[model samples]
Target chain A: MTREGINQLVEEHVPKLVETITTHIETLTAPQRLKEAMLYSINAGGKRIRPLLLIATAGSYGSVTNAAYKLGAAVEMVHTYSLIHDDLPSMDDDDIRRGKLTNHKVYGEAMAILAGDALLTESFSLITDISEQDLAPRDALFLSSRLSEASGALGMVGGQVDDLAAENCSLTLDELESIHRRKTGALLAFAVEAGGLVGTSPKEDLTHLRKFAEEIGVAFQIKDDILDVEGDESAIGKPIGSDVDNKKSTYPSLLSITEAKRKLRNHIEAAENALKSLSVPAPALFSVLSYIELRDR
Target chain B: MTREGINQLVEEHVPKLVETITTHIETLTAPQRLKEAMLYSINAGGKRIRPLLLIATAGSYGSVTNAAYKLGAAVEMVHTYSLIHDDLPSMDDDDIRRGKLTNHKVYGEAMAILAGDALLTESFSLITDISEQDLAPRDALFLSSRLSEASGALGMVGGQVDDLAAENCSLTLDELESIHRRKTGALLAFAVEAGGLVGTSPKEDLTHLRKFAEEIGVAFQIKDDILDVEGDESAIGKPIGSDVDNKKSTYPSLLSITEAKRKLRNHIEAAENALKSLSVPAPALFSVLSYIELRDR
Candidate 1:
């Protein structure tokens, strides 16, 4: 598929993915305020990159199943919940996210916490609810287990803890990479691998997909750092140089901007190589890689 | 089995349950601090009532399986996560829990939040980790789905949201019951029902166990209210009259003390009737009911 074709595919499916996510949340028999708080964040705009990656990878192997869409929604919900909690007064203490008031700002801290909790819990339930016809119980169990491993202490949460600890102190490049690998890479890897599993892709293809995701994950973060240093403030949503202002280390801080760009290119090339190793063409995944390399926000 | 025999059974199994729970947490390759925060809360003294209830129910039907122990651990982890979040400064703001500093007080708010998040995510993972030989994938999926329903937006979290909103306002008895039923009753019901499922008990018996759990759950909360009004501060591990001070509605406040006691007795009787309806003798469940009725703390 051409880049334009992949872009069109993303545009068409993003809305459907959002609908899938919202329908799940809407069908919940929870309190009105809680649902409102949850939907408020869900409706908040995002690029739906993670879900798209999952679907695209699944598409690379075969048809993207309905279970893939549900899994996509599940991953997005986990991402949103992490953001909600990270924006709390005691955490990042951010007032705005996605150009709107953060969850705690709108719902109050207590409600925001519960909203995050509910989202995290429901993500697993969402997985289990997928029909056996769409995805077998054994596969569902594998997906659920992998999701938790990617999001829990051994993955995103652990990385977040380390990131917080690293603030106000410089970290070695290896340490920095270690944090980002778990913090951001783990879930992205899960998204790609899950798509493979859902599509029943060969084990070797799944391994290559994981490597592709890992490279892109780091490349994506490095690109964000580079953009923070050079991109337009308006294009990025949040203010630029906030990392510098906060005295935190980033790719540009530890390495020169030119060197960080070089590293980013290296990762992108590595990702492309992983895609090349796949038995099937992955034009959508390649498109995603290009987008990550060039995206401003 | 006699009440004394049931008590002996509980005494022997509680330590084994703790060991199983601790082993799971210990095996996680998360950050040291994250693991410490999680273990600290897990080791903090509680009656381990939820896991015990699950195990006892399973035993009532047949010999308990290793999967039952793991499931019990998963439920306890969810319970522990809830308590950790509940004790946060922005939530209940309690500085202490189980006579020790709250997780936030010790680990700080950010780590406390992450720890809770890890616990919640891992609880589902734990279910998936259960061997298929011990518990079939279908049954594991069912348990995971039920757990999330009991603990997510529709259940414990929803009830908590309502409970927080009800503070400083009068609530009807029905409203009060509704809140407790979700906030506390849902997970309790899950523990009993899950035991039956794991033990491969008859579907009819599972229904009775759920009814038994539902009755005891409300009775448990009502008894908590009564204890708050009359029990020793050191024994309960907190000062009495906190609900009154917080202006939160409770059974003793909504109804007179005499009326509340009567209601508690009625629920206990209903719980006993539920156990009696089960095909298998449930002396262990009866012992638990008796404990709930008479315990000071």
Candidate 2:
């Protein structure tokens, strides 16, 4: 698939993936208002990077079963859940996310927390539903384990704690790398590797795919930090410079923009090189790499 | 085992179960404060009811193994995490829980939220660890599904949202039942059912255990409502009449105190009957029923 073809596939699948999520959550016996609150944020939609990557990676290897879309949506839900909780007054305390009101802003704090909790819980249930049909239970268990690990304290939650602790404190480039690697890199890498896991990719291919994911994942966060300094505000959507306002140490803050871009380029190059190690052409996967390199600028 | 024997078993096992939780959480690569927040709350130690019930239930069926203790600790972690979040300023906002400062009070709100998130994620991972050891993958998946359902939107979280929503509103008996049935009942029921799930109890036995759980689970909540109105404040520990102060509806408020006791008695009778249906003697499980009835009087 060409770059346009890959983008087209992503575009086509994201809505269906969201619909899959809405449909599953609808079956929950929760209150109507709680369901509405959950759906409100989910329906807002965002980059859809995680789901699209999982699908595209699986597609590249001819293992894009129908189950892939649901899994992709599940990953997105987990991401959204983290964002909702992260935006609470107690956490990041952001008023806006992705250019709209944060969950607590529209739904109130209690609902926002519950909505996030509901989403996280339902993400796992969605996997089980798929396993009941297309995927094996053991395979679903594998995905669940990976998802939990990447999002757990040792991963994104840990990074958030570190990030919060480092606020207003100058961080070395290594400290910056360490925090972002857990905070952002874990889930992004999981998105790629989840596709491999679901597709039952060979061990060698899985390792290469994971390397590709780690490199690009770090690159993606660095790009966000770089964009906070240099990218067009409208193109990026949400407010930038909040990091600066909060005195958060970022890529551009720790290293010169030129040096940060150098790091980003290195990660992107590493990602591209890792992709080449895969036996298959993986055109869609390559498109993913290019998209990350080009995003926000 | 006699009731004293069961009491001795609980006394013997609670420390081991809590130790298991502490050891597992100590291994997390999260920031120090987050781990501290988690341990502080887990160390506070409530009744150890959930894990003890799980172990006791499994034990009665001759399926209690060392792995069961770890699984019990995981359930306790989930319970502890919920309490941490529930006591947040955004939620219940209580200062003290289990006779200590709540997680947010001790670790600050940010670490508290992250700690709760970490505990929730680790709970599932802990189960997966047990599955990797003694359980079949499918069996672990089954347990995970049940746990997520009981704690998810349709379960505890949903109940909490409803409880929050109904704060200023009047509630019917059915409405109050709906709330607590989801809020407190689900996790309690899950403790009993989880033991059966991991033990591979026969379908008929599972049904009886579930019935027993549901009856006693609701009974437990009704007893809480009763204690709030009439039990000794010092023994109950937390300040009482906060429910009435909050003007929240309760069993005694909705139905008279006498009627509430009548309802409790009926449920307890039903629970006792359900226990007899299990093919196993379930002496420890019976003692659990007696303990709930006797506590906080």
lDDT of 1 by residue, A149-194 (tens): 9999989999989988988999999999999988888988899988
lDDT value, residue A117 of candidate 2 = 83
Best model per lDDT: 1
Model 2, A1-297: lDDT tens digits are 245855786676777888888888887778999999898888876778888889888887776877787789778888989899999997789888777889999999978988988888888877777756678877888888888889988898999899989999999988988898888889888888878877767787988898998898889988888888877777766787888999999988888889989999999999888988998888888877777777774
CA deviation > 4 Å runs, candidate 2: A1-6, B1-6
- How far residue B111's Cα lies from its native spot in candidate 1, in Å, is 1.2
Q: Lowest lDDT 10-mer window, candidate 1 chain B?
A: B1-10
Instruction: Summarize candidate 2's per-residue lDDT along B102-142 as a digit string, tens digits.
Output: 88888898888888888888888888777466787787788
State how far residue B295 of model 2 sits from its true place (Å): 0.6
Looking at model 2, the pairs that clash are none
